[model samples]
Each structure stands twice: as C-alpha cells, then as structure tokens.
Target chain A: MGDNMSELLNVKNLKTYFFTKYGTVKAVDGVSFKVDKGETFGIVGESGCGKSITALSIMRLVPDPPGRIVGGEIVLEGEDILKISDNEMRKVRGKKISMILQDPMTSLNPVFTIGIQLEEAIKIHQGLKGRSLRERAIELLEMVQISSAAVRYKNWPHQLSGGMRQRVIGAISVSSEPRLLIADEPTTALDATIQVQFLRLLRELQEKTGVGLVFITHDFGIIARMCQRAAVMYAGRIVETGSVRDLFDNPSHPYTAALMRSLPKLEEKVERLASIEGQPPPLNDDIQGCRFAERCTVAEHQCRLSYPDETEISDGHFVSCWKF
Target chain B: MQRYIVIRFIQTVITLLILSIVIFTLVRMSGDPVLLMLPETATEEDYELMKSQLGLNKPVYQQYLIFLFDAVKGDFGKSIRTRKPVILSIKETLPNSIKLVTVAFVIGFALSIPLGIVAAVKKGTVWDNMARVVTGLGQSIPTFWVGLMLLQIFVVWLRILPASGMDTWQHYVMPATCLGIFLMSGVARLLRSSMLDVLDSEFVKMARIKGVRESVVIWKHALRNSLLSVVSFGGMYIAIMVTGAILVETVFAWPGFGRLAYAAIVNQDFPLIQGVVLTAGAVVMSANFFTDILYAYLDPRIRVQV
Candidate 1:
C-alpha cells in the first residue's frame, strides 16, 4: 500500500449492488484500493466485472432505483465522502474529484459548444465568469493541445473528431485541478493511433498537475504503460493487487495468470490465442465459495466451500486465492 | 442556413398548391353551390343565371384554372351565402381562432413540460403514476364530451364561468382547457419518454459527474434535449388546433375559423370551403417548416447537415 501521508483516495470494502425486479445484483462486492498523489492506479477487468461500477461508486454516481452503494467508505484526503450531505458531495465531485467517461461521442452534450461545456465546469468549480472565464477556458483548450483554440471553442461536439472531443473531455475533467480524476475507459472508442496519443496526453497532464488518477480499462497494454500500481478484478472482487511490474512478472491469482496468458505475445508464434473458458457466474445468485472457483484450474474442494482471504506474498503484492 | 430556409419555403408553396387542387375538386363535388344560392320558389332561370354569374357554368378544369389564377392574386372569390369575399370572412374569424389556439398552446406547454420532467425524473414514484393517469385520461377522453362536461360543471353547477360565446375571458377558460388538455397530454407523454432516454444518456451522467446541482441537471441539461420531441409535436398540434377545433367551437359557440368552416361546409359554400381548407393547409405546412428550423437550432447535428 502507498504511504498514508501521500494517499489521495482510499476505498475500503465498497459493495455496490443493483436491486432489479428479479433479484439483487452484487455488481461490486467488497472491493478495496488506494491511490496516491501523482500515481496511477489501474483497474483491469473484462466487461461486467465491476471495474466501472467501482469508479462510479467513488463518484457516488451509481444510477439509483436499481443500483446503490450499500456499503462503502470512500476516504478522500482524510475525509469520508459517503457521510457528507448531497450538497457537499456535489461540491466534492467537480472541484475535488472529477471523472472522464468513455465514448467522447456521447459524453458531451450535443446542443452545447465545446467551449461552453468546458467553461461550465470552470464556472462551477473556479467561480470565474465573463471575459476571464472565456480566456481561462481557451487556455485549458490550448493546454490540452487543441490548436486554433479560440475558433475550436465555438465548434459543437459533433463538429470535432473523436480524438479532439476526448481531449476536450480530458480538459474538462482536469480544469479544476482536482485531487483525483477517475477515467472510465476514456479511450475505448478512439482509433488505435488516437488512443496512443490520448494516453500520452493523460500522462503529461498527470505529471504537470500531479493529480492522482484511478485509470479503469480492460486492456492490459494500457495498464502496463500507464499504471504504477494495478488491481486485477473478477466477479466484483479484487483478485490481485501489486506494482505493475510485479503483476506482469508474477501473477498470483489464477484468474490473473489466465488473463496474462490470454494476451497475445509478440515473441511467441502461435496459431490460436489462449482464452478463458466459461462465463462469469450470474451476480444475482448468492455464492458461498470463491466466485472464480468454477473457472479456476487447480481449484480444490476447499476453494468451493469458502472464499479465500488475501495473503501478502511480497512487500506490496497481495492475492486472494486458496493456493495463496 | 439561408439555403435551407429557401428550400423549406419552396416546399411549403408546393404543398399549398397540391392542397388547393384537392380542396377545389372536393368542394365542387359536394352538390352545386348554385342550387344553395337560389331560393326554393326560384325557377330554373334563376339557378342558370346564378351558375353563369358565379362561373360554375364553365368546365371543371377551366373553373380550376380561373380559381387558381385568382387565388395566386390572393382572391378566393365571394361566399355563396353571405356575398362577402371568402378571404375577408377568413380575415375576420382567423384572429379569434388564433387567440384561442395561442391560449391553449401556452397553457398546455406550461403544464406539460414540468409534468413530464417531474414524471420522468421521479420515475416509478407517485408523481410518475399520477402524471401517467392524468395524461392518459386527457388523451383517451373525447374532446367534445370534455367540453360539455366542463360547461356543465363550471357554468351550470359552479356558476363561475360563462357557458358560451367569446364575450368575456371567462368564456375562454373552459374551451381553452378542453382544447389544451389533449395537447398537454400528448406533449407530456412525448416529453416524458424523451426525458427518460436523455436522463440515461452519457451527457446527463457526465453533467452529474461535474457536480452540477441536481436542479440544473434536470432543468438545463435534460430538459433542453427532451423538449425536441415536444416542440415538433406541439407545432403540428397548433396547426390542428387552428383548423380542427370545429367541435369545440360549436360546443362553446366561439366564432372562430373552425366554426366558419363548419358553417360553410353545411351551406355548401364552395368558395368559402376552398378558402378555409386552403388556409388550413397553408397553416399546417408553415408550422412544419418553422418546426424544422427550430429543430435544427436545438440540435447541432441537424444544423451541420443542413
């Protein structure tokens, strides 16, 4: 774990559930992680593995009626945000911690110009208005490396290319210099070339602002390149957590090992890529044993009887598995 | 943008031209206007003189050509029953219809927008169900029945309002409410579904993530997008209110364009009928044209394409 003094975000045993008509979906169950200032904490998982839900939980943005954070302590800069009133929570959202969502195409309001959207965040958090607000918005655009910032400001979201819109979204997220920024699959919709450029921009922005980032994505390559510390999740739980280097070199959990093996290796000439067999168990049903026990190879009877506890294998590496 | 407007204008002209042809043919087919003009005691000579004088003795195609030529110059001929110019009759009664429709539209829009937004935001709550039931009843109930019931309650029972005529603002209350109820229900239902879709959209989620006040999120962000469908439907509804309020007009005894058209049709007044139908068609087309322009303004994607 990162030192307490430098920690910017600490999420402890967060459980976010969805109460549908049929049953309760334990989407994010007992997940915990921490992010330090100027550090990137990567959350890597497949679709429906609660990576996105965990981020939404941090922002208190889980859609209600069906979804709710049932149990959680989201401590940000020594304060537990879960205990705050909605008004105060609203203040915490943009000013203290902001989020950049996936799909730049749909992330921005189509009716508004990019400048107005950017200026909106600035106005709300920084309290700048009139000429100064406009200038600051243009400056933020320039900082995001959008050329012809003054003219582009007038362009709507539809007028910009996918990459440019993502940049604008990034600019909006960091406009307030938030202590933490949760980027939920921000580049999934971008073209491959644009994806590389966007990741680089994120890194540069983090270095400049020294803001902690909770980077959420399914791509291992992104986790390797962008994250300092990474957590592998499966069935709404963190299966493993360690330094990115340690995770890549020595995957502790069976699910983590399988995911690593499934990634196409450039050095190996193989006809078929490795794939994990079987789907994740339905979340609505209560499971007594380890959630991944069904798909995990070398699982003993004990693995199916009860969930395993996290065991530290190295100084900062931890894994939850019967073998550990 | 200028080009787009010019295109829409041309389209409106074409639409009105087609409508005029339909109205001309349909009105002429409805028993001869000459017979209606002549008294029962008049001889055949009287009918023949009236027919030739009114140019009904000409071939159908030739009569249409003359009608078209005169119509292009803004002349719709004189009414068979009243001997007043058809255009003048419309000019007189059109303002009353405009007033009623405007009042109805304002009330309907004012009530429906908030109702729809509240219903959608608090979906599955008591407010949502209440909105649903109210709008459902508004849509399902017959307009004339609603008007008569309102008259019975407000005028006969409560004695708070006038029963008929456009004599006072009190007379307008029941009629406008009756007309506006249908519009309100339709727009509210449309806006509710639209708000539902928009509330679930990524932009709305992003707005909330920005820590915008919940009110701002619902009112400014969600409301703007949801209003697109409402504006389109409301525009068409306004056209309907202008020309299709005959039943309400009859029930309330309001001397509007709809009532004028009803009387012209009953009297088999060809020129007046043509005038009314053509005018109604023009109103409908122009409403649609303006709606398209407003739609473009509200949605940038459409503006770019145009």
Candidate 2:
C-alpha cells in the first residue's frame, strides 16, 4: 500500500478545540496521519468521535467563535499550510487541497444554479471565463457522470435529486484538480444504491486524477471497500492505524475488536448483534486515562490510570493500548 | 412563468373585489353621508330629495351593484364633500404620496439591508450592539411622535428644513425620515436574524471551503438569501406607507393619499372614502403580487413550487 508514492499531506499532533459556555471541547486531540499521492486513507469513528472535525481542521475551516485549531502542523506538498498567510491559504484551498463536505443536500447553495457554482470555483482558481468557463463547467458535470450535463448546468440545487446533487458537489470540488481531496461522510445522506455508485465514481476519479483522498466515515465497511490504509478513531484520538488488510485480519485495539464484533456477519448467525457497553467520555471535561477504558472489557488497572503510547505491532500496523 | 403571472393577476382581481365589498359595507355602516351633507334647517321633504338624488333610496345590494359597475368603468362617482369626481381627487393626491413613499421606501431598505448585513457579520461585536440600539429605538417609537420630534429638532429647533407641505424635496425630509425610520428598524432586525441563519447554513461553509473570498461570501451569497425575508417585509411596508401613513402625513401636512383618506373619513364622503380604500387595496394587492414574483426569482425552490 505504501510502495514508493510521494507524500501528499502530512498532519502531525493536530488539536482542534471548541470553547463553549459549558467548557472547552477537545474535538481533535493530538491526532496525526499522512496521505501519499493517489492513496485512499480512511478515518473511521462513531458520531462525535471527531472524524468530521479532523477533516474541517485540514481545510482550516473550523467555525471560530468557539472552534479553533489550537495546535497542528498540516503540511501539504512540502508546504506548512498552518504557517501561511490567509491570502496564501485561500489560494491553497480549491487550487491545492479541496474538500467535499457531508450532507450534499445542504452542501450546494440553494439560490445558485449548478453551472454558476461550478463556474465560480473555476473562475476563482483557474481564472477561466466566457465560453471556456461554461464549457469547463459542463465538462465537469459530464465527468461526474451526470446525465444531460448541458441541461443540468442551469438547474438549481433543489431541482437535482440527492444523488445528483452529491455528484455535482463532487464535480465542483475537483474542478481545479486539487492534489488532495477530503470527503467527510459524503454518502451519509444518500440511498444505499446511490452510495455504492458514488463510491465507485470517487474511486474512478481518484484513479484517473491520481489525487490523494482522505475518506471520513463511521462505517468500517466503507473503509475496507475504499481505503488502502485505515485509522480507527476512538474518543477524539486514533486508537489504531494500519493497512486495511492488516487491521481487518488482526484487530489489535479492544475498541476496534468491539466494533468488528458489533457488525453483523453473513456466515455467523446470532440472536442479537454484539454491542459495546457505556459511552465515550464527555469531551468538555478533562479525561484522565484512556477515553475507552470504562467501556473496554479487557481494561487493565494501568489503562484506567493513563493513556498508552503507540506500539508498532507490524511493518505498518500500530495500536495504542496497554495490551499491545 | 406566464401562467404564474396570469394566476397571480386573477387572484389580485378576486382580492380587490372582496376588498371593495368590505369597504362598501363598512363605509355605509359609518353613518349616512347625506345627513352630513344637509343642514339642520332642511325640511324632511328635502332630506328625501337628497336621499333619492344620491341613490340612497335603492336597496343596499342594488347600490353595491351600481357602485361595482361604475368602479369597473373607472368611474368612482363624485365626492359628497367636494362635489368633484372621486377619481380626480385620487389623481391629484396620489403623485404626492408616491413621491413621499418612494423616498421613504428607498431610505428604509437602503439603510436597513446594509445595517442588517453588518449586524449579522459583526454579531456580538460593538457594531451589532449599536445596530440593535438603533433598531430598538426605531421600532419602539410611535410614528406620530417620531414625526413631531423630527419637526421639533430639524424643522422647529434647527430650522434647516421646511416644517410642512410638499413644495420642495426639503419639505419631504422630516416626514420621509419619520416614516422610513420605523420600516428601516423593523427590516434591519428581520434581515439581521435572517442573515445570521444564512451565515450559519452548510452552503455558506461550503462556499468558504471553495476558497471564495470573504466579501463575496457575505455580500453575494449570504446577502441574496437573507434578502428573501426583507423583500416580503418591504413589499407589505410599501402598501402600509401608501395607505397607512396618515399619522406622518397629518403631522407633516403633506397632501398625500393617506391625508385624502383621512379627510374623506372625517367628512363621511362616501364616494371619496370608497375610492381611497379601493385604491389602497389595489396597491396592497399589487405589491404582494410583485413580492411573490420576486420570491420566485430569488429562490428557485419557490419557483418550482409555483
């Protein structure tokens, strides 16, 4: 999976915190990962486990009156994006690293036509206009496999179906051919059939463009299907990271093992699906030990006392647990 | 699109017909205009003659039919008080009202939209607080009092502007400001909240992620969506200003439609009263019709629904 591909994005110790009236929420705490050019990296976690926030942090778009990226070095193509000026960062976005957000239903502006929106990104990043701009916009629509591309160009967001809107959003994100594309649960709002089609389309686009894709979702099924390497996030931190084959074949972290058990298997028949007990720790309060310790069936006394360091179990597999 | 417009037009006509019936019945209930027209020394026979002359001797429904027929022909009968055609009076006064209301509408929306945008963008900042204070004062203050205060400050004390009448643009200053201030504040409050909601929407976040400039996001994307609420409010406001600016018009001595309506009510001039109300109702309906069209234009969702 890691054979000689140039690195596209390198994020180290990224910490994004949200200061609310109640207390500060450490959404992404000391998270770190890397994506090589043309690689598909998946971040899997439950709702509120900070997978979305991590993607938003990479985009440098955490809504500020409360949320802030407190610490991080997000380097893309040998450039530290965090250190650049806002003007320079604007250029980097769309042109260098674009993002496809969750919920395509609300991702596109309601008042604008799909064509105008597609053209806008091209106009700003590629500086295209007039006949060329319109042509490029229609071409993007066709590339996303949208039927009646020319007719769909003038159609508003409300005119398109959920699947079609997501496709248009996909087209707009990749219009500038960014080196890295961050898709945050792009299929959650779509139907199961449409989800499969969208994922396939994403993989095809990735193969054609050779763009690094950071796929964020809670579903491990998607991780296994789309990712070359995968990270299992638990309570705002990555508990396990490895090649997809390694992680699936030999799950190391107790949390990962619990998640695997929870999934309904086709071969094994059961009365009820296996479920994890208890909840993740509240992010607002200070967490003293392993965030998953209370819920871990095999938690040791040491696991309750403090967090564990990452240990390399294989050539690429790493797990953070006292057992490891 | 043409179908929508035709449907809206038919709806407007139906609305106007209903409004005419309401005004016609209500005006008659106000008391006999003939009594007001006659002197105390008039004989009972003279009263009968006056009643028959004015066609009050006819049944109420018959009188309404006659009124409706004449109204369709653009003949609003003669004013009982002035002894002139009702349409002539409306024609004479409507231009002044248009001039005043147009200026006020311009001032209200021009100031309110920007104020609302600023308040939303700078939410929780000093500018937002200041806008809150301004809108609060504008909304809370009565229109008549505001008019008088402007008269007291700008006209009476400062003496920089005219006190009454619509001879010059200078005369419009205090009255238009007084009228516009209330609208401005209400719209600003509406726009501020709407803008806040739009700014928080997912599409706005998407726009920022697209590397669009901050100014473009706020002014173009956010402002256009937020203006939907403002446009609806502004449309109704124009109707209100045209027919309901009696307080401001009376205070400023501006010879406008509102003032004409006020005088007709006082004199119990049946034709004039009916004419003024029907005209005001038409204006209101037309304004709303235009507002709906604008809504369809601004939002494609509404257009598809239509």
Candidate 3:
C-alpha cells in the first residue's frame, strides 16, 4: 500500500468534446493534470470553463453520442485508461477510481434508502454479501460522520438534508477505498457552513486513507483552502498550474492575476476588483489565437493571431500566455 | 395521515351524493316513466298503475331519498328489463371483467417495461428499433382485429388454444391479447419516455461515479425513479382498460360487465344502463383515488403539505 501511494494516478493531454448538432464543443480542449499519490489536486474555474469536463474525462464517464473524449491519454497508475475495454473500464471504475458528482440533491437516488444504495456499490465491486456487506455499508456511513449511521441508513435521500445527502454520497464514493477519487463541485449546491464541513470531511478522509484526490470547482477559495496544488482553467484550457502558495502569491499570467484580484479583500479600499471582461467564447467556434484574447486586457496582435504554449513560470508554476 | 385520509373520504362521499342525485333527477326528467313502460296500448289507469308501481306517485324529493336509501343499502332496485336486482346483475358480470382487465394489465406491464428499459439502454440500436416496430405494430392494428387474427392463427390454424369464450385460463389468451396489445404499446411508450428522463438525471451519473454496475445502473437507479410516470399513468390505463374491455369482451363473447353493458346499451334498458354505468364510474373513481394516495406516499413533500 505504501509503494502504491508513492505513485497512484497520472493523466496526459486529455481532450473531452461535445458533438452537438451545431458543432463540436471543445469543452475540455487539450486539458491535462495529475493527481499524485495522497494529494488533493484542485481545478478551479467559472461555470462552463471545462473544470467538470476534465473530471468526467478522467473517469471516462461522459455520456456519449453527444459528448466524448475525442483524443489524448488518461494514464491511471501505469495503464492508459482510454485504451482499456468497456468491461475493463467498469472493473477499474468504483474499484480503483471512484467519483462523486456535484449537486447533492440530484446525485443520490431519491426513491432508495441510503443503506440500499450504499450496499449496491459495495456488493457490485466487492461481491460481499449478507452480513458482511451490511456491516461494511454501516462502516462507510460511520466514516462520513453521519449521526446514528445505523438508523440513518434506512432513511431515503429525501429524508436527509442536503448536507447529510452529500455526506451519504461521500460514503458511497469512498466505500470501495479506491486509489483515486474525483469530486466535481461537491459543495457548490450546499450552504456555506455545510460546504465548509463537507470540504473538511473530504480532506480528513483523504488524509486517513491516503487516496489521491482530484477536486473540481469554480470557487478559488475552496481550492486555496483544500488543495496543496491548484490548476486554474479558462475557456477549457489550464491558464495556470502550481502549488496554492505559488499560484496565489506570485501569480504570473494576466488571467491568473485577474482571478486573484477578483477575490474580496477587507484591507483595501478598491478602485476596481479585476474582472474578466467578456463572456467565454462560443464552444462551437474554431480556435485561432488565444481563446481568451477577446477578453484579455493586455492581449497583443500576436496573442490574437495564435494560441500560446504553456510557459514554465518557476520550478513549481506553469501559465499559458505570451506575457508569461 | 389519518386526518388527510378522513378529509379525502369526506370529499368522496360528497361527490358520490351529488352524483346519485344528479343521476336520479336526469333519469326522471328525460322521459315519462309511465309512457316509457306502458307502450301505446295502455289506458289512463294502466299508466297510473305503472307510475304507482314505480313509486312515481311520491314527491320528487321523496323519491330521491328512497332511491338513495336503497342504493346505499346495496339494493339498486330490479331492472325493469331483466327483472333482476341491479346490484346482483352488475356483480354477476364484474368479476370476469376484473380478471380480464387485471390479467391484461399485468401481462402488458410485464412484457413492455423491461423491453422499454432495454430499448432506452441500448437506444438507437437493434433492440430500440425492434421495440419501436413492435409497439408501432401493436398500436396500428385494431384490438378486435388482433383478437380475430390470434383466433385464426392459434385456434383455427394450429388448433392449439380454444376459439373463444371465457371457460378456462387457456381461453384468456385471445381476449387478453386483444386488450394487452394496446396496453403493451402504451406501457412501452410510457416506460421509454420516463426511463429516458431518469437516465438523463444527474443521479444516474452520480451512481456511475459511485462505481455501480451497468445492469444495476438501469434497474436500481434509473428505473426506480422513472416509476412515477408509469405508476401515475397506471390510473388512466386501468380506467381505460375497464372501459375498453367492453368491446374486447363482447367480441370474444366473454361474460363480463363489458358484454353486459353492450347488451344493456343495445336494448336501452334504463335499469341495466344505470347499474353498468355506475359500476364503471365506481371503478374509474376508485382507481383515481388509489393513484392519488400512491402519489402522496411516493412523494413526502406532497404529504407534508397535506
């Protein structure tokens, strides 16, 4: 287990696109990140910035027909998950890598009791049955800090509050004790206090189990608080990637700098909090230069003519912009 | 829950009382009891004798109370045409129709729901296409025609099952199939749409993220939530089933309320008509009531408000 934690998950150049009647939406266009052994890696961006898409792409759980991972590799551990068979993928899923989706309200099955749903995941992946499965399910609920895990187990999703439901989801996701866990905006729908509690619970679970974490959200505050390393996404591209301290203290990219300025500060009487000026480009349009050039305040003619490669800003930070 | 139930019960009673009074008044107003019964040969006293027999000598308000009393006591009075108590006569035929409709409904659900789920899961593939074709074919052909076609193929052609009439379980195939075809198509369509809605729910994705199996994904997660549409639509389906069974029963010569109603309608026997109409109305009302109760049980938010 110690050796396994030394190197758990890796992803490279992953692209997830939505094939619509209008055109292909490059939702996660050439996005790449890694979740190393026993670390919380956060992806932060605004809505429709492809933060969630990258998470879905890693799980290979994107609904097909309209959306698909069109290109690139997702190497989980030593194996390339994109190349695996469907059956193999199913085996890997929930057993080795599990995910908990956003929106606690909709994520849990409304009709079923939390225990039955929890047992369902345990039984499928572990093939444990009868008393053992029941015991394990109770234990998972306990791990998530639900009160009276035994009694609450019989309650349906609607019976529980939104925060309780989120905890229940957390229980189900980590029941398998997978090497990697992907949480897509798990607290966005929760109340502020509940959100803090849920995030704290996730961090505690990660520390206890030493599971690699890929947490996606639009809120940079959450990223700053929960993650050791953070990546900032803009228009489906990672504009900045580094440790929380490096990304925040010496933010290099103009987009990264703008994002930092947007955060509310009590100390300063602000002339202006930095704001990205334009709506994100229509996902269907073909990309030429920088996808953010239309919105970039400091964008030059070259920035409009062609997209830029990722620039290494330091030993730890990387940003994608010409001014880097 | 008890209070809620009491409120519902009170409401149903008020509704039934209004219905009985309206039916009683309408039956009286439409045509003369004396003329309708006596024919052209009747003298004045003879008309008087017929009116007196029907208790028409009593005041309109008095007549309504007497009728309501008899109805509440399960005596709907003897049919002028059949000379049998209306309640007993209707009861004699209701069981058979219940059997026929219930069998048809169960078989229809059994056959279509799983097929619908499979179609949605393997959507746009061979299974979906096949389901679409089967439901299409089921919908297009008139039910009686299907009964006739089945009778010919299985009875006349192969001589495997009975030709017609409700004698044994073996006899139910043609009649039930006749009714089941349309229901099967309806169930298939309902299940398909509801299953699609559920499949598209964020919960399904969440379940997948939890590492649930593909088979479990469809049945345990998607279909469970999708049941609201199927179960709610079940009320309307069962109501239609009772109504539609009349034709199917008459065609197959099944001794059910449908056949009885058909005969009563053709003969224009007011007593029998009243009985049969009341029975059908009762069944429809009952199905709707149960459906409402079920909806409340399934969704707690509704129960909380109540």
Candidate 4:
C-alpha cells in the first residue's frame, strides 16, 4: 500500500482496446482515476467515450476476442487485480468490487427467481445457505425498499417494474458488502422521478455501508447530484478531474467548459442551450494529440501537434490541456 | 395457469377433430379400398358383394358419421385387411413407437444441448467449427442412409448387434441413433443460436459481475433462458419422430405403430390408417399443449400476457 492506501480502488493508466476486423478501437486509452473509501467518483462522458468499458475493465469482465485490457493496473484495496489470476480475480469481484450495469430491465436473469439472483452473491461470497441464505435474501430485498420482500423474492424479473428491478440489482451488488461499487448508468432506464429516488437510495446505502462508488454516466445533472469528485472523459481520456464543486465552479479543460455551457440552466433564460460543435475524433489508431482539439472552440496549433500532459491547477484540481 | 391449460385443452380437442376429418376424407379419397383389395379380373358381382360386405354401399356422409361415432366410443372399427379391431392393434404398437421416440429424444438432447453450449461458448474456434460440420452432416444426410450405414458398419460387417426387432435393447441402437442424429443436429443448431443469443444478453454479463462462476453463468443462467427455444423445438421434433417413424420402422423392421401404419397404407386398411393418423394427431396436439405450458412457465411475460 502507498500513502493513499485508503483509496479503495485505483485504476492507473488503464488501456482497454478492441482488436476488431476494421482496425483497433481504443475504447479506454490510458484512463486513470482513483475512487477513495466511501467516496462517489463520477465519470461523465458521451455514450462512446468508454465509461462503461472502463467499468467493465475494472471488473475484469470485458468481452474478449474483440476486446482486451492490454495494459495498466486495477489496484483494489491493496492488491493489483490486473496482476492476479482469473480465479483470484473472481474472488475480488462481488466480494471487494461489484458492479451494477445499465438497463435494469435486462440485467437480472429472467428465468431465475428474485431470491435466487439476490442470494447468488451472498452465497458465493458469504457461504451462507439454507435458512440463513433465505433470511439474507429477504433482508436484501427489504434493504432495497421492495415491499413484501418475502413475496417479491419468489417473483420473476419480468414481474418486477423497472425501478424495482434496478433496486434488486442494487441489492445484489451490495449483498457482499463490497468496498467499491461501480454503477454504470444504473438509473438511465428508470423514469425521471424513480431515477431521483433510486439515486437517493444509492447515496443513502453508500453512506450506511461506507462503500466507494464509481458512478459512470453521461448526464452532468446526475454527476452533480451524486458525485463528490467528478472526471470529464472525452474520447476515452479523462480531460479534467477535481471535486464536483471545483469542477462546476471553475472547469479547467476546454471540453469541461463546453460541457458546463451546454447544460440547461435553471435561473438563466436563453433561446437555446449551448452545445459543443464537431464530433469526437475516431479513436481507431493511437491518437497523437488531445481528442477534443478538433471540436474545441479555441484550438491552437500546439494542441493539434501533440497531446498535453495532466497539469495540477489547484490543490485537488487536475486538467489536461496546453492552454492551461 | 389453469385457465390457460383449459383453453389450450379445448383448442387441442378442436384441432384433433379437424385432423380426424381431414385424415378420414383424404384416406377415403385415395380410392376405393375394395377395388384395390380385389383382383383385376373380378366380375361386377364380386365388386358389388365386396362393396355390400364392406359397408361401401352406404353414403359418404353416413359412413363418416359412423366412423366419427365409433371413434367417439374408442372404437375405430375393424381393419379392412386384417379384420381385427383397429384400436387394439394401434394400442399394442403405440408403446414401441413411444419407446423408440423417447430414446431418440433423450439421446438427441443429451448430446445436442451440451455440444451447442460448448460451441456457443467456444464460438469461432476448432470445437465450434467441428460442431457445425458434424451437426450439418447430421441434418443434411438422409436418415435411412444413415441407418443403413450404421447397420452396414455395426450390424452387417461387425455382426455385433441385431439389425431389426425390438425384443432386446441392443436392437434399439441403430434406429434410435439414426432417428436421434437428425434431431441431434437440429437441436444443436437451434440450441447454439439460442445459447449465443442468451450469452449475449445483459443478464449473463450481470451474472458474471455478481461473481458467479463461469460454469454457473453459462449452465444456470444462459442455458436455462436458451432452453425455451430448445424445448419448443424438441416438442415439435418428438411429434415429427412419432410420425416419421414409418420410414425408419420399415428400414429396421421394427414392429411399432409406424410399421403397422405402413402396412395399412399399402394394403388399403382405411380403418387402421385412420386410427394411426388419429393417434399421431393426438400426440402432436398434446406435445404442443405441453410445450405452450412449458414456454409460459419459462417466460413470465408469456404466462401473464397469453
């Protein structure tokens, strides 16, 4: 363990690439971040910006053949998970690190009972079974705020509402009481009202369990509501990283500035919301420079020539830009 | 669930009734059985006598009514060629046919599903390619040819097993294997595609994230969901095997309902043919009913919606 051994999960320079027939897809290129104990670290980016892939890579559950985690270390607690064997990694997953994926409607196995699915992690990690497992499953269901947990445990996934199913997923992920929980757009499929409630529930659960969370999403609104620290990801690279308040008040990177400008304001009235122009550059080969340079409003010749290194702006704020 | 079963049951009855009518009329329309049974040099007197004796003198509608009435009472009348009760002979041979088909179904599923899952898990690899080639051959080559080949190798050349008869379990090997080969390929292909679809589903990925072992993820989660298609396909395959037993029965000389039906068809035994058709129809209908129930149970959405 290092000086910041308290950091529950540290993903250092993670590089996950997809070797497809049409060339390589640099899904998560040298993405680096750390989620401290009991902290919510948000990774905000557009759909193809590799937020989910980063989460998957950390879990060591990335689909192979086309995708591979080519480099970098995923250090959880103390051990570097990337260096461990798959069998050992399986022990790490759900026990120390668990993930709640996107699309709650299809996340749980449809053929299995809610109880069986909830009990799966508990049984695997805790070795509880029979009456105790049943009790644990009921407790987990109730923990997620599902009414009549006993009855609901026997229900199939298709019988549950989207919100309820997502809660069940939350319950399953937390069953092992993992130190770090990576939630990849857990509430994206939920209704707006339900999303708030779910997020609040997650936040409360995290507070109660003291579990670190890697909240990955595209919505800045959710990032503001949930995250303590936030990173703005652009084309698989974290362009800016700081406390939510610092990032919101004074974003350093151009991409972060553009993102803040594009967000809909509550107090201010405008004819149209500001949107960053230009599509993100194709992440096929090794990118030479800042990915946002092409889309940047104030791009310089130096920005296009080569990639900029991360610069510490303040005590906790870091930005990657030549302009800084 | 009860309501669904009841509704399906009624539907099955209606379907069976329709099938019986079709079989009766179609078999009758194949031409006069008496004409076919009698010699070509038979006089008009012989034709009239045979017609009167066989109740061919009655109108078609009367004959259908008589047939339906007898069918309702579990009596399919006497066989035109054998002069024995049609139902009695069918009842005697039905178990053998059931046995053969059941064996085939078991063997097919036992081999196919695992192979399919393995192929799906190891997609695009040597195991997958080999599975594709083997299953493709199973489906493409004729069943009779396969049976003959097995017989030539196992029975004729090696002289290790009996070629025909159902007296010993050894006799069931060639016919069952031949029958199973066809179904095995179909089941493998179907299960492979279905397993691929299910393995690609979000639930499977979520299961892996839950720290579920790879075997549990594949066999428990992926396999269970994938089985919906396999089970349905299997039900249809069973019904097909029951009816398609004719060719296999003839080739192996297995004394099943299929062999009896084959003989009936050649000898113009209308009552016997009708009995076999009616039995086949019932088997198909029941299989469909069970499959629907199984499907609904597997998918709660279907259980609630339909």
DockQ of each: 0.82, 0.81, 0.59, 0.77
lDDT of 2 at A142: 97
Candidate 2 per-residue lDDT over residues B1-306, each given as its tens digit: 677777888999999999989988998888887788899999999999999998999999999999899988879999886789999899998888888888888899889989999999999999999999999999998999998888889877888998889888898888889888988998999999999999999899888888999999999889999998888775678776764487889889898888998998888788898898898888788889898888878888876675
Candidate 1 local lDDT, B1-306, one digit each (tens):
777778878988998888888888887777777776778999988888888988889898899999999987879989878889999999989889889888888888889989999999999999999999999999999899999899889888999998888888887898899888988998999999999999999999999888889999999899998888777775678676864488889889898999998998888788888888888777778888898888888888786574
lDDT of 4 by residue, B93-128 (tens): 989989998898888889998899999999999999
Q: Quote each prediction's TM-score.
A: 0.96, 0.97, 0.92, 0.95
Q: Model 4 over residues A112-156: C-alpha lDDT tens digits?
A: 888988888899999997999999999988988999999999998
Candidate 3 accuracy as lDDT: 0.84
Q: Per-residue error at A34 for model 1, in Å?
A: 1.0
What tens-digit string does per-residue lDDT give for candidate 3 at B1-306? 666666666776776777787778777777775687677987998988878888999998999898888877877777778688888878889999999988898788889888889888888899999999999898888887887788789988999998767888998888888898899998898889889989988889877766667888898778867777777786688777876788788778898999988988887677777667766766776776677677667654445455
Sorted on lDDT, highest at the top, how do the candidates line up?
1, 2, 4, 3
Lowest lDDT 10-residue stretch of candidate 4 chain A: A1-10
The regions of model 4 sitting more than 4 angstroms off are A1-5, B33-62
**Candidate 3, after superposition: displacement of residue A116 in Å?**
1.3
Residue B205 in candidate 1 has what lDDT?
91
For each candidate, give the interface RMSD after superposing the true interface residues on Cα: 0.7, 0.7, 1.9, 1.0
Cα lDDT, model 1, residue B178:
88
Docking class of 3: medium
